[model samples]
Target: MGKNQKKKSNKRFWWVLISVIIIVGVGSSLFFFNFFGIGIDALNNSDTAGSVEQKDLSKKEEEKINQVRSTVGESHQDLGDFVASTHEFYNDTTGYGGINNLDWEEQKNKSEQVIMEIEKLTLDVSDESLKQDLQSILNVSQQAIEEEEAEDVRSLHRYFHDLDIALNDYQSYDRIWNVTETLKEVR
Candidate 1:
């Protein structure tokens, strides 16, 4: 009986040891391969799934894109000029007070004019992304107008920041820099 019990104990110990060794070996191999960046491509199908190559645009498509880009660029420039004029009017102390003392009614009128100009500007592009961005800009502009009407300076500033981001032309560094400058001026 004692011999049988000893044999059973040894068998259990050996089984547990072998199981532990196998587990440790597998875990170590996974860690080693991952650390060395080995077999990672084989294990990960993410690159294949996520990396979609864009097809080359046709002549007509290229023309359309260029037209949209030009329109967006021109519109941005015109709006920027108008905003600068508005800023000048706001900062001017000839008739009113300085930057510290703004005429809310005059500011509201200027914002309304901006909204009107924004409404008049049309994208006429089929690109969903551009259309969405334009819509976001319009929405934020409207919100900013509302904040201006309510005389909420802080909320107006926040909405103006959102409007600047929404107006970002991802292709132009100059546009980004200009937006940054405008934001600094606003502050």
Candidate 2:
């Protein structure tokens, strides 16, 4: 009876040891290969699944940030062109036209289109000052557009001056610099 009991205990010990070794080996391999699902399946916990999901979410967010940054960079370049066109309307005199005789509809339409593009971009900035700066730009831009559409020469000229200043500030803004830094990190 004693011998039989000893043999049964030895068998149980070996079985448990082997099971543990197998589990440890598989877990190690899965971790090495980045197959984290094994942890979730074997452990029956949500930690691994949650972490994987978080990583995927972060990747999506990074992609969105990159897209916005690219669009904003392109838009910034176009902004300079818009300013030039506005300047040209005031400076270049054709044989048929002169200063103060300019039709601003074309420029207004272009500005509105660019504004729509900017509105479509997702700006998830956290800084209060940056947010205010962006708001100022939007406000000034809308005011300028309204004045242009109304053909209010006085207000339009004033708003255009304000828009120019806002745009210049945006060109060297901290938020844009921060975005550039973030792009560097993602790369």
Candidate 3:
């Protein structure tokens, strides 16, 4: 071929090559985005499902409150054991205060944990009224604990007393059910 003719042929070859590359790249990207979209959709669905399962939001808020009550039952058992142990130790040692000063410190720490945990009890459910009620319960418990712990005690009796009342409200099936039933009625 003549020099100009040969140069034109090479230029055409390059154009064809570039066009093929562009077509393939665009096609691949479309496929990738389509598949990626499905993956993202699946992930979102599972995340929502997992939240419901983990929080037991599928059941009414009342049921979740009832579960909290059962947990308090175990906590009561533990508290009773702790009180007995402290008493036994105090009796075994002459002039020993009912429970050492350190016990109070530990309980004070526990008070914060309890307050934060109950406060953060996420009601992902959309019932604003139920959420407010749960917050009220937690607030009362937090206030009682704060007041009780501010006092110095020879024993853990007062601390446990406040804690028991806090748990009592949480464990009351009738009370929680009534509130939840009311909420359901209004909704």
Candidate 4:
């Protein structure tokens, strides 16, 4: 090829590369605060009263449940808020191409499943609420494995499955967190 032709081709290649980098950077960075909201807060809260033990079995378990429950709530809030707002941003920025991506529809189904799990996690108006609550939250955690980003679906599924195994280590239907909930109540 001629020298001038080679120079023009190189310029075009660099321009395309720069454009891709700018688009990806802008897309990924805009969601940083939203993505890490609950994660950062719960880490900061780890040293609070909820982490300590209590004298009574019932109270100690209750406190532990409360701690885990609070963390779960924060995570749900962070993800829910971000997802609810994303459609508006996508509508404004993507000019319909983004709407065509079937990934969003799959994500929508996963989020709905989590919402159903959360619905089950609420109080049952009974005195023995902790048992039901723990069971519900365990189900919710399983649902969360399904709710992960599409890019990591299989990996997350396997990871959370392992988490499930670890949680159920005592040969019971209930889990370590079930015992932990006894602490949260006592605290």
- RMSD, candidate 1, Å: 18.3
lDDT of 3 by residue, 40-156 (tens): 333343122211112222345555444543554344444334334433332332122222222444555554554565455433323354345445545544663666532222222
lDDT of 1 by residue, 98-135 (tens): 22334567656666775676566544434454444445
lDDT (C-alpha, whole model) for all candidates:
0.44, 0.41, 0.40, 0.39
* Per-residue error (Å), model 3, residue 103: 48
Write the number of the candidate with greater lDDT, choosing between 1 and 4.
1
Per-residue accuracy of model 4 over 29-125 as CA lDDT, tens digit each: 6575345432233334321113223242354553554554454434444333332343233323222222223255554455455446445533332
Taking the tens digit of each residue's C-alpha lDDT, what string does model 2 give over 1-187?
Answer: 6999999999999999999999999988878535322332334422122211212225554455446445543445445345335433422321122212335675466456545744543254443433443454455557646775322332223233323323332221122112122233333
Best by lDDT: 1
Model 2 TM-score relative to the real fold: 0.27
Which of the predicted structures, 2 or 4, would earn the higher TM-score when compared with the native?
Answer: 2
Clashing pairs in 2: none
Per-residue lDDT for 156 in model 4?
Answer: 25
Give the Cα error of residue 137 in candidate 2, in Å. Answer: 2.0
TM-score of each: 0.31, 0.27, 0.25, 0.21
